[model samples]
Target: MSKKKGWVEQTDGYLNKTPTFQFILVTILFALWAIAASLNDILITQFKSVFQLSDFATAFVQSAFYGGYFLVAIPAALFIKKNSYKLAIIAGLTFFSLGCFLFFPASRLATYSVFLIAIFVIAIGLSFLETSADTYSSLLGPRRLATVRLNISQTFNAIGGIIGILLGKYLVFTDHNLQEEMARLSDAEAIKFGQQVLQRTLTPYIYVLIVLIVMIILFSVTKFPSGKVRKKSGEIDSAKFGETMNYLLHNKRYWRGVLAQFFYMGVQTGVWSFTMRLALDMFPHFNEKYVANFMLYSYICFFVGRFLASYLLSRFRETIVLTVYAVIGTVMLIGTTFIPNMIAIYLAVGVSLLLGPGWPTIYARTLETVDDKRHTETAGAIIVMAIVGGAVLPVIQGLISDATTMQFSFIATAVEFAWVAWYFISEIKYDIRSTVTNKSHSLED
Candidate 1:
């Protein structure tokens, strides 16, 4: 097999010998992170009931998870700089496994605070995995296939979603009268019941931790095409963190894209976490659980859309796709707000069709504005910023749901995408101006 060039790496070892295992292994690890993210919503009430946590308290699940992204992103960059991808990924696996195991004691003790701590540990691990794996995966011999690389990783992520939803639904809610029990339980009864309910989650996560431990161990001994980039490169020569950040600060467009990433992520996370609730709560006749289950199919929309963007952009100019999806996503948001039917709720979910195209597209477009000076950190930082959407948008939805009806909370949610639109508009303006300048210069020449 011929070797590929640039940020792509396609050594025969990873390809001809171990392609299936390599993809499966990486996909499983990424799936662990996704399960943690998506399952939190399905099991939020379980957390609440078990620990007597409030909606605000339960929101900490998101806070701790996303907060870790910000906390660990820069540090993970440094770690990736200091260590090989193997070591960083192993460390992430260790963090994730240990984090999952902590849930057992948290379950036994039934402490909300412990659960938060446990979840934070999981997030800490995931931040490293994301930072290392995304970069590592990108380098594994097909930069052109980055969208495919990421999509394959994310398809497992979607599989994890299906697993989490099924597991959460099965375990969290009791067979008996939960509403009545919730309404009239004495302290002793509640605590006892909470313990059993806690077991439902605790058991699976326990198994997950064990599996993660083995995955890490196996990965340690196994060799594949090493895609490790030399640590930090030229970007981190300075001793002071402040100096590096200042360098980033001086790059105006780099920072602009980062901030835009933050808002875009907040919106995406907000919409995804709440889509089920939005369907069930807003539409009276539909069953919440059923609606939530049906919403899993929504992943198909996302998966298809992303693949389409990848294929389409392979041929067409990215500027065209970026402008179309951004504008269409905005239109969908507006349409979602006006359409009151349950059928329209599913149609609103189709907004994700356009939504899936956004990530890889945005990353490629952002690269246009950035220099290669701090490529990994700049790219990872943007992704880190996007996680803020995960933390902030849910609270915004929860708050809005409290003030008004649940349906209109999406309106608040859609505003986050407003930034996505701005990015697209910026792309259009930049592309047009560049094109016009090129044409004018050609005329002059």
Candidate 2:
């Protein structure tokens, strides 16, 4: 009992040390990204109907968004390395606001391609925000508290996701009668109605754009703690792409974490992308609004799970907790796959609880292993690049769903979680405590 109290005190000490305002700002940034990301699920459903697309085609929404993450990661890393995290954040907001505003043109044009372009641009902004915000949050306090800080921030992120889904459900998702009416119209009339439907989708984004603009102004004027490049003997050694690539390739643990992250992201994005589909499949009478609410519930579970995991992480080793969660997630996915009823739906929702801690835990764990602060930015970029898995796996799942059934497509998610569990088990010997001790020693020396 005393030992548990000591653990809580230690974690609280670290939390107390973090600058209150900075933490709040960073948490809000985390929430902003979540709001943007969750909106994609709504887009997938709406675009499918709006553009008359197939499952495989609807999957392109993820492709375009995460593809932007893949493409912009390195550049975002370079920008942060050359500048500061504050600048990177502002630049990210610039792109984010611009992308939101672009929805205006996309809506006016009423072209799916243009909407994809807007989403891609927004993703570019998000890539910068994610890389910078993640690193900044991790570095805000004691290295040991990195994952906890990120999880706390991500709790707000889940809240943002809930808000996004709700907004999309109420504002963006058209009424069933409207959809039915559009179906009955002549070809030209249907196109006009579709254009009107697409234009309505722009409203939420406009509101988002306004909020982003306000954030940009606030960020520009407020002073942020310097996240400068760490130096050895007051000399800055610029990271070379080739050398960094070689080093990362040679590090077995590093690459393995990368792979685990890839599969984890794939499963996460794939599952959320298809949650509504799976729900509809199980209950054919249900509407989009019902599925959206379910998605909101899943994120609520996600929010609560993050806090729960953060508590567990305080008491246990991160890798052990991660391994346990991964295994549980896999079991849940298996139940979701084999069980075909309302029970399967509940099991699928349970997967969110298990998934809540995996991403931040893996990220903080992987970054702990890296010895050089110089490499941290590049390392972050590589991890962000792995988000392309969100693009690749979901599309594959979509194709599989098109070929088979939605329940069967979840096999991909199950397999991915199995890999994550295996990763934690295989790398159990490389514990974070040792890495933190080494870092402390190096700093003292």
Candidate 3:
């Protein structure tokens, strides 16, 4: 009988000389942000019901959250360059905890705009965490296997997403017919009920806030690997934003990645934001709490997909695996849009399975475009900024849903995945040509 290999064997030395403990510590940061982001989906339905918002208006939940990622990513990168990834992680956790703490007051105020403010603050912190953690994870292993390593880390992120949706399903979503109840109540009674829903929303954040505090303390004490060791403070060249931006602009591959990430983020956010809406629309008998069960299942598929993608990435070409996922995702989303049946909605939920490998794969590939290691931090920041698509694309979907049916709105996500498929196809073509050219040159030699 053959002996079974462990995870280290499976990685094929991708983890060679990697700082195991530091990687574990930094990987936790992935889950931290994912929990916050996934909870936003629950918030969208809760806020829409409590505040009586249109689909378009309710999407501002994503807009405010990802908008902070857009604005803060560059500054967070600069901070990491001047300071350290470890410090940036701590700063992010602090900001996150602060934002989570604000949920108490936001709940008390029971104002949509105020809650958006708290969510934006949380996004600010997440921007810091993402800017630091993703780049940090890529650097933890061999450059070639960066995607695989990041995917391994992202598995925890999937777990966090699952936990978040579960928390929202149980703690936030109410079983009662909120619309009918609100319609029947007097103004004072409605306000009281709104406050109660807001209180339920605030409970999850409190648990998250406690976890963030613990993480901050743990990160402070742990020793993290330094990407670039500097003996003198003067060796830190933090003023290279202009140079880095110029370099990034000229890199075609990196821009392709940026576009892919943009669409992917948008579709990912929009799909989850409206999943509950779609569930309720398709099956009128389903309550918000029951619809949330589909979200839970969606995240579970995502969790499994991450683990599966990571394994496949280790065994196969990253471009090949990603291309397959993108293609499948595009087709599934198309089915989700046009097919008017239970299967159509199931396709939407199944999209999460394809989504698991996207962000990390694009991220690792984009960073590979930068030949100079010095620009990695800045380049990583700009890529993180592409997450703003989460802010923009969801609103576009929302507008479409409001104008058409919820089923038709998913056309936008289908288009987004089509772009990802094209990007990965181009990657495969480039790799093939490069391989052919190198082999021919070797024969001549």
Candidate 4:
């Protein structure tokens, strides 16, 4: 009885050690990025129609968006390392608001390139937010609780995704079947309709910009902990930038995890980016609003899956659970590729359940292997840079869809998941062998 009581006290200690208010604030950043990220689905569907683009051309939206992450990640990390998480977050929000505001002009211009530029700017903000918030959440608690904490925070990300998709469905997507109607209209009338549609798309982003401004103000007034490990003189070590980069580069586990993360993001982005198109292909009668509802359902499933996986992580090894989820995801992707009719839609949505845990799990596992606290910023940046996979794979999928069939393009996602599963399996085997070798060495000694 006393042993159980002691365990309870220890758990309470870990929970109490975390700054509740600060953590909540950071978690909101998670949700902010999610809202922007998931809206890509709506953009993909709408832009393809608005611009009269082939699959390959429309995928440049993702290419530009996630390409911003690749470009800004290292710089965001350096900024965080030089300053504080609070300041980093403020900068991120500022960029986010500016990007959202840019959508207004882009909409008025009705240019695809302008819209892509807006997305790119927004993604730069998200890169900063993700790098800081992910590392900050991990830092707020005990190392053993890192995965659980991240998973909990990401649940809110899914919530934001649900909201984004809902808004996109009602505000950005039209129910008037503009494609068919535009076919009958003269060129001038079609241009006017396109401008109206583009203007409607800007409404939700205006709201997003206002909310981000409010958040920035709130963060500015709030006093957060320094969130840095103090040195002997109670100052952060700003001189270790190069050393940290070298260490991260040489760490086998870190690089391997980065590779896995690349593949994971590729599969995830490819699946969601194509979901509406897939729905349209399978159910020709369904409107964009209905398909958007389907996306909302998938995100809800993803949200619930995150909570469930977090619970499971408390009871099982994270790697094992991750492996199981990866295998399940791989199978679902394959099913989505080969299956016909509505079953393919079901399989596509089902893949979200398995994918829910992949990002946080991979992130926590990799960050755990790093020893230096000062390097957290750089390490987090490298991990975030793996989001470039979101850029690359979607373009590949789009090209495939253009060249062949939409369903056939999901083979790209399936291949990526298979690689993730293999990564976990290899890591597990390596862990077991290391454990055995260490035991033998101890016995001989």
Candidate 5:
């Protein structure tokens, strides 16, 4: 037996098995993911002004950004599937750094479309990182300790989000009005002012670009552990893509996770994507920094939730725990629905505290329920489906915000959590199924 241990046992083993350098390297790599992942939030108001767009068009910014996830998921999934995880990560980081560098030029060009294209490219690179990184982390230590390892590494990602919000708020927004004022003049006069806008932001991004490039170089050289990391090989069978799609479609537990992830993504994305807009519309007392800090705290709650899962999931049945979490989440959303004040904003963001562990628990339970060989393909699809929530939901929220008040936009988010509550219900039903079936099988075995 492979020990079949739980989180505490795994935590003890981790203290002994983990090396110091691996921690440093993984933290740095995690920072990369966080910074890149959160680039959109930092630039929200800038994009709105520069593009002269409504919430609808600005919404596509997320779609275009995350749409790359849908486009690249298959190939990236297969790439990691067919090759070594190391190779996939190397490729992912290289392109991700490349994508980060693209912002340099897009900033210089001052072209909105080019900026979206840069984001698309960056997301294409991130698609690989998103799939590979968590799966890679899961394989790093004792299986039960996987959540701890991932949670620790992911804290740096939140750190990156904080830095992104600060830099965007400070650096990007710094001469935004000047850029606007210069635009009021003729093209030539505005060009002079435009150069200033580009120059100010352009320099800071260059610094960020150089730092990321250096980190990429370091990650390339560092030796990351590949635990039970099997690299699948063979020709690029186009048919396998179709087969993988069909495989997941046929598997009920797997699809259940897929739907769970969909709603989860919607909830997560809706909260983060609309926080700035919502704060402004509802809580006039709070400024952007307050909203930013509010998000940071909510994300901190997300981290706390993940770590708490270490203890919680082990003691209670996973379904019961998940059910309670969902109910809490639904209640919070409902609370937000009733309150038009900052109470709603705080409650809405606070839901992240309950959500942190849900995905990993779902991942653990679903993968355990499925065939071993399918892990990589299914992981890819599930994570990618998560991006679909990012793609579709935010755009819808954006359109909805434009149509009505941002306060009313909470309804779209409510629909998302309702689906999540149902996912928990399914898990409860499945838990009952597993208990009886296992009892019967035990008699036979």
Candidate 6:
């Protein structure tokens, strides 16, 4: 085969000699990180009760976790550059497992700062996993199908999020009345009770550690495709860092996708953080567990939406689908803000459905605009770093809630969805202009 035709065939086949097992394995990594992030959300409430932490202190848990992502993303990409994706993933799993093990000591010491350190370590591991795995999964497929592939992989991510919530609900939160009970205790007694509660929080991490070890073992034994990039000059190595950054800086489509991704994370994390509170406020008769189920439902909707969106992307224009869903999500959040009674809460859950494709779609579209395939890993890392928006925007939502109302806070989320919609709308125009320009040249020829 000629080199041009050979490359075209390879880029056109979805799994093009990629092992099914390896692809499945990489897809599972999506779920693992989602579980970590959702578990972090659970930890916030758990720490507030067990550590007797003020809201500001509890907020540090997120700060440490997301800060780790921001700090580790570039390093993780560099690590993948120096080593193989397999090696980077194994290293990430090792960090994750080690961090989980540290929870044992953190629980034993009952020091919030120690636990924060442990969370940061886990986030570091997650940063590595996300940076490698997301890019790796896309590499496993046809270039044209990358968006659908990522959306399918992220479906498992949504599932993992649900699993994390379930773990928190059943394992970590055995005593719903623990907070009330703590209020009744003497200072020393409360100290002892808090320590015991902290000890119980260690259980879920132990389970995660066990899973990570199994994953490590599997990855170590598997043989994977090289997954190297092919430059126009037929080189296997990636572009240099300076060249990559210069290209990225000039790639307006790429930076716009990154901005859209940032807003999407902000919308998602902000909505999840307040879902339960919104439920409780709207339905005063409901208990915590009862309202908490709405969050579970929201996660399920998100999971289901991903699968549905993946199918849609396979059948329709990705930008069109993304634009439609985001616009619908924006409308739903606006309704969530102004609608009264139970309907508003339902609208909030429904928004999760519309947002199902936001992250993966944004990621795939951004990577598509990278002219040099070698830059994919670094580009992926920068997008992963955008997750810091998750840490920042919820705080914005919280402040809005405090100043105005919880319902009013969703207006901010609506604006975020609007931004995503606007992004794709602009992309659609770009696509049209490019098509017209190409057709004009063809007619002249």
> What digit string (tens of lDDT, one per residue) describes model 5 on residues 1-445?
1222221112111222555565566566666666665557655644654545677677776787778877887678778666755667677777776776887788778877877887788778777776777666655566557666766666666677656666656665552243245458887766656555555455445666777677667767766543333223422222356665666677787777776776777777777777766775675545554556666666677767766765787787778877788878877877776786778888877887787766666655665554544445545446554667778887788878888877677778878877887887877877888799999999999
What C-alpha lDDT, on a 0 to 100 scale, does residue 169 get in candidate 1? 57
Tens digits of lDDT, candidate 3, 272-326? 8898888777777778888888889899989888888878877877789988998
Per-candidate TM vs. native? Answer: 0.82, 0.90, 0.92, 0.92, 0.81, 0.89
1 against 5, candidate with superior lDDT: 5
Candidate 4 TM-score, true structure as reference: 0.92
Question: Where does candidate 3 stray beyond 4 Å?
Answer: 1-16, 142-144, 229-239, 437-445
User: lDDT for every model?
Assistant: 0.65, 0.82, 0.85, 0.83, 0.66, 0.80
Question: What lDDT does candidate 6 reach at residue 88?
Answer: 88
Regions of model 6 farther than 4 Å from truth: 1-15, 52-57, 231-235, 280-288, 338-340, 433-445
Q: List the residue pairs that clash in candidate 2.
A: none
Instruction: Provide the lowest-lDDT 10-residue window in model 6.
Output: 1-10
Per-residue C-alpha lDDT of model 1 across residues 1-445, encoded as one tens digit per residue = 3333222233211232225566567767767777777677665645644565544455677878888877887788777656556787899899988888888888888777788888889888988887777656545544556556665675566567666666665655444434346548788888787777677777668667777878888888866555532232312321235655665667776666666677666666666666765665565455435555544666667667767876777787676876677677766766666677766577567876776656545654554464443345435554655676677667777777667755676786567677777766666677788889999999999
Per-residue accuracy of model 6 over 1-445 as CA lDDT, tens digit each: 1132123324222344345688799999999988887777677766766777654455567777877888899999988888788998998999999889999899989999999999999989989999988888877756655655666688899999898878877777653555667888999999998898888778778788899999999999987655666544544557787888998999988999888888898898878767766765566555445555677788899988887887887787778998999999999999999988788999998888887888887887787788777787899899989888777777777677767877888898999889989999988976687679989999999
What order do candidates take by lDDT, descending?
A: 3, 4, 2, 6, 5, 1
User: For this target, which candidate reaches the highest lDDT against the unseen true structure?
Assistant: 3
In every candidate, how many clashes are there?
5, 0, 0, 0, 0, 0
On lDDT, who's better, 1 or 3? 3
The number of residue pairs in model 3 that clash at the backbone is 0
TM-score comparison, 1 vs 2, better candidate: 2
lDDT of 5 at 439: 100
Q: Alpha-carbon error at 176 in model 3, in Å?
A: 2.1
